[model samples]
Target: MPYSYEPHYFEDLDVGQTFESAGRTVTETDFAMHSMFTGDWTELHTNKEYSEDGPFGARIAQGPMTFILSTGLFQRTGIVERTVVAFLGMNYMDIPNPVFIGDTVSADFEVTEKRDLDSRDDAGLVVIDSEMTNQDGESVFAGDMKFLFKLKSDAE
Candidate 1:
């Protein structure tokens, strides 16, 4: 089934089309779980009361938590199931608004650039601008990511 539903080749990608996913609500478990992994023990993120007295007036997801969630949300698209060679990295990331616990979040993408790597005939580079938004349509995070994908020729 994975092979049957292989990802599109670089040439097959639609630059202007957006990719999106169902929203996932941030939860206390999400915060605690990620905090353990990242060592982000900020009171503003871990304590609801402490957060309520702070700027956003509620406990919010950590910036890195938002980043990780956004990536996980986007992965539900399974774009890499067929041809992804590697996840390059992210750039120009900003967590503009707080993402509070119970806030539902979703992610979408726009293709920013695509280019065939001269050094690799079987692979190419793809750049995407991704944004994570809350239920109210407020953007909580945004960034650019690059991917190296195996071309159809390489799949053979």
Candidate 2:
């Protein structure tokens, strides 16, 4: 069965609600583009020869790149496109494994908490526990993401 793509408002979300995104393969172009955009030319990420001698034995994606990719995967689910007001922040970001080129990855998210904003009738706060895993099932990134979401009553 196909996973239903449902539009969600702040009022529609509840603690323990979970979502998983489709996989995307990390590519050389992703590395190069990220490097060029961020001016992060670290040897381990940009130099294959240098990376070959490093602990991981090959070039690895930058930590921030993995986070970016995870966010992209989350957005691909289309759950937050129209309801999100702002990204409040992230906490406990941990990269437990390296993301190598050609490795496929996906993101999983679960609502951890929700709070109505006393000062803002239009929005509420939500914290989501996020994890990104590789094809091998090793976690490449994990964190708690907080966002401000528009309430259903206020979205009209």
Candidate 3:
């Protein structure tokens, strides 16, 4: 789905509430730019000719790039928008499949839990389960992400 543009406050999210994001095609630019930005020119990801003889038979995108694209697609869905306070952390991250260039990708997000902050009534903590897939519906990335969010009363 495309962007829905809702600023989700702490109270607005519920466990099991799910969201889907629009697709974005992974490109050579993505691989190259990520390689340039991170200085990760691992032969399997950067040297196509060398990768031709290696596993997967082609250069694959960086695992970090998959995470980046997945998160970017999630934000494109507009769920956080101006509602998010800060990203706390992630848990159990796994990259189960290779993300090749030209593969369109999207994210499926589910709110798994919510917790009240002991020090603040204006903010809360939330956990979301995320799965990223390619056009072929193969799992590329999966994780639980934690975030700090403003409560409804604290949202403007």
Query: What Cα-based lDDT does every candidate model obtain?
Result: 0.81, 0.89, 0.88
The clash count for each model shown is 0, 0, 0
Candidate 3's displacement at residue 148, Å, is: 0.6
RMSD of each candidate relative to the true structure: 3.3, 1.4, 1.4
TM-score of candidate 1 relative to the true fold: 0.89
Query: Which candidate number maximizes TM-score?
Result: 2
Model 3 CA lDDT for position 42: 99
Cα lDDT of model 3 by residue, 1-156, tens digit: 345667788998899888888888888999999999999999999998999998899999888888888788778778788888888889788999999888999889999999999988788999989999998899999998898888988765
Reference-based lDDT, residue 39, model 1:
91
- The Cα RMSD of model 1 versus the native structure comes to 3.3
Inter-residue clash pairs, candidate 2: none
Over the full model, what C-alpha lDDT does candidate 1 score relative to the true structure? Answer: 0.81
Model 3 pairs whose backbones collide: none
Looking at candidate 2, the ten consecutive residues that score lowest on lDDT are 1-10
Whole-structure CA lDDT of model 2: 0.89
